[model samples]
Target: MTSEPAEAEPANQPADLFDLSHNVNFLLRLAHARGDLLFNEAMGDLDLTPRQAALLHAVDRCEGGNISVLTVVTGMDRGTLSEMTPRLVKRGLLDRRPAPGDGRAKSLYLTPAGDALLQLARQRTASLRERVLASMPEEYHDLFVKMLAQLVGLETETRIVHDLPTVTRRRT
Candidate 1:
């Protein structure tokens, strides 16, 4: 009897040799976690979580913003934002009101206190970012941003390709 040859695994599999994509993804997660920890530590006195800071910043930029807009801007889910919004409102950092055009939907606004906190959070975040990037040469910053943007664009394209068939079929 003749034995059939075994199929080769895909190059991008976890067991593949020298997979730079997996290595880069792992490093990205690690860096993000470390950055979050550092940012939270820096904002400890101000009592602002990173998500809260982001939400406040979004509200400051888009006054009378709806929850849908916040979800898009912050990439946070409705449930999480719902939970956080009440707390922020209670703390006088945010104002939540029913939308004038849509009574069932609510809009978010940043109070003066929220603005102040956001400014402080920006300063803290900027300081932390500078410290992290200090070892890298200034000339590399633009290049780094461009490379990261390319990676993001590629990922977005892949997502669109994967989802387009399902989305189109759903409409039919």
Candidate 2:
């Protein structure tokens, strides 16, 4: 007797893989823009940008992550970090202090007000994330997150590159 398997119907497969709306790049950009819009809307009351919120939250989590560490964590360039840090400090949302005995090395922390703001930002961010994921099956959220984490880096001969490293010179 023949043992060939029956062919699956076209209903189980996409008719075309090259559709622009279904393209990964297009989809990613569309989703990012939508998320950005919602995040800006939610954060407008506090006049906080996404980067500012990220920096504040990162500082809150790390008692004294230095500028270099924060640059790495927040994925912000030195120029932008320098500009934003002082503004946040001026606004009393962040504290910038010298690291222990190193007058040149500064550590960042969230002030009382920053902490409260971070809490509110966190709540809003979580709500936005939930809303975004609502279109997908709940069972796929973990897998979706995992797949996203995988797509971020480009592999090199010996390493994977995501973002530029934050470089800090050391005293001799």
Candidate 3:
């Protein structure tokens, strides 16, 4: 019997590009590195890293919040807070106490010094943000920020910040 012509296989691009350069994760990392450079340059007297500023900013938004909440919202591991929080306290920028509802949870509050520094950080960071978005189409700025928020929000939700193991990689 004459066989019908075999159906042609539909050609399709890969579901994910194999090249690292084309990977979204690599792109995000590259973007983060570029941002760090810009942030460091603009930080000037502030000298806070992007993550540190973000932590402080989150605390400001919380008004009076606990480490558990901060860890979830800030995407910072407890070890990170252990290192940075003490320094912030030493610098008179942060104060900690037992959470109102839960004594086991440590609550964080921004000091007047922290408030002042936050305001200045906002100003400096605004300038840097503007510079970063300068080359992008002005209309895309809102979309860019929104998209990043969506990505971060989704990623943060998936992570169980409290489930971290005790041992940390040695920094060297």
Candidate 4:
């Protein structure tokens, strides 16, 4: 049988050229960093990190959310959450105690001070978000939020698969 013609190789180019993966990663990093900078500046007086505000918000909804739940909800590592919990506790923004039924675990609750700070942080974050979206059309805002949610959902699914050995190793 006649051999099939060999496929032509793509032309060699600089690493920066035609590197869509790098470009996408750079764009993500820049957008997140810039947004974080703007948010921090906007909420400077609130005396809370973005994650701290999120934790307070979560605790507000859950009443007595524990570290494990917060870890799942916030997508933060246990070490980071452990580190942050005590600081928030020291700031009078949160209270941590042994869980009612689980002696091995600690539960987190937002203090009155924490609630007040979270409200302020939420207001500032909303204002900043408004300013950022001011240039975009209203219709696009809904689409943007939808796309973000989709991305987050995909990320969560990937994390879950990676975390579960049976799921990760399953045959297609």
Candidate 5:
């Protein structure tokens, strides 16, 4: 008697093995893309990229901070901040001076123009935040931000701070 080979099915497999809609990475990417689109439409004439704005804001908050400090505060790399500083200085939006203790290290500061632009950007972005939050339920607003902060290891940080760095999504 010949016995038929028994078919074995994988145990506990999902109906759709690779469902992107339920993927964290894919969801984060889509959220980022949506944020960028909203920011671009909102910041009509700012011409400042999100990275550039973050750098400027960091300089303003940390006045006289060097590239290394900006990197820590902005979550940007040394190379990108180094490249951006010169361009901002050329545009008269930032000023670079020799660090007080370290002559070789240059400190950064936002010029009057940079500060003004940043203020405008902040206003526009406040509205953008409202729009983004509008999509989710009102009760989840704080929780949503908390969850994001936790994801980025900022859960321990105070929820409200006068100088907390803003995470913008717009770019030129």
Candidate 6:
């Protein structure tokens, strides 16, 4: 039998090839999980998820804010907002009124209770963000936020109408 030399592994290979802690996708997921954990820990007593709080904030901020406007601002899908709106209404945190021009559409507003809770949530989350940023270097703060915004296309605008491909059925 002929003897051949074994190939050498790359010098820069990681200690564990499967270790994904530094991977972009893995890190994004971990960061999201950590954010949720911290948010829950800070605001769990308020009985609102982060997204719910965001929706309330959006409703308060968006001019003539309705579900469609919220979808654009919050990046939440229509179906999700549709489902979430009623729950908040049930909790007495939101008031849904028929839009002036559109009877079928709803314009959302925060109730007194919702506004109070949202104010508290905003303070807590702001403090939480400060703490989170404190853990990282000051120089990286803006860059970090900018990078995340780019990832999510935070500045992208949604169009009400777009071209659609026509589909034709083939006769068999």
Candidate that would win on lDDT: 5
TM-score of each: 0.69, 0.71, 0.74, 0.73, 0.78, 0.77
Best model number under TM-score: 5
Cand. 5 Cα-lDDT: 0.75
Candidate 5, pairs of clashing residues: 49-171
Q: 1-172 in candidate 1: lDDT tens per residue?
A: 9999999776667665345556877778876788677877788899988889878876765567777766655567889888999999999999988877789988788888987888888777767777656768988966776676566543332243334321111101
Which run of 10 residues does model 5 get worst, by summed lDDT? 163-172
Better of 2 and 3 by lDDT: 3
- How far does residue 30 in candidate 6 sit from its true spot (Å)? 0.8
Task: Between candidates 2 and 5, name the one with more favorable TM-score.
Answer: 5
TM-score of 6: 0.77
Q: Candidate 2, after superposition: displacement of residue 147 in Å?
A: 2.5
What are the root-mean-square deviations of the candidates from the true structure over C-alphas?
10.0, 8.3, 8.9, 9.3, 6.7, 10.1
Query: How does candidate 2 fare on TM-score?
Result: 0.71
Instruction: Find the 10 residues in a row with the least total lDDT in model 6.
Output: 163-172
The 10-residue segment with the lowest total lDDT in model 1: 163-172
lDDT of each: 0.72, 0.72, 0.73, 0.71, 0.75, 0.74
Write model 3 residue lDDT over 1-172, tens digit each, in one string.
Answer: 9989998655443544546666787889989988888888888579688878977876776646666566765777878977898889888889987777677877788899988998899878768989888889999998898788778763432243323332121111
Off by over 4 Å in 2: 1-18, 153-172
Could you give candidate 4's per-residue lDDT for residues 39-79 as a string of tens digits?
78888778777788767776665556677666665667788
lDDT of 5 by residue, 1-172 (tens): 9999898767535634446766677889998888788888877588888788878877776778788766766667899999988999999899998888789988787789998988898888788888878989989988998798768754332232233333222222
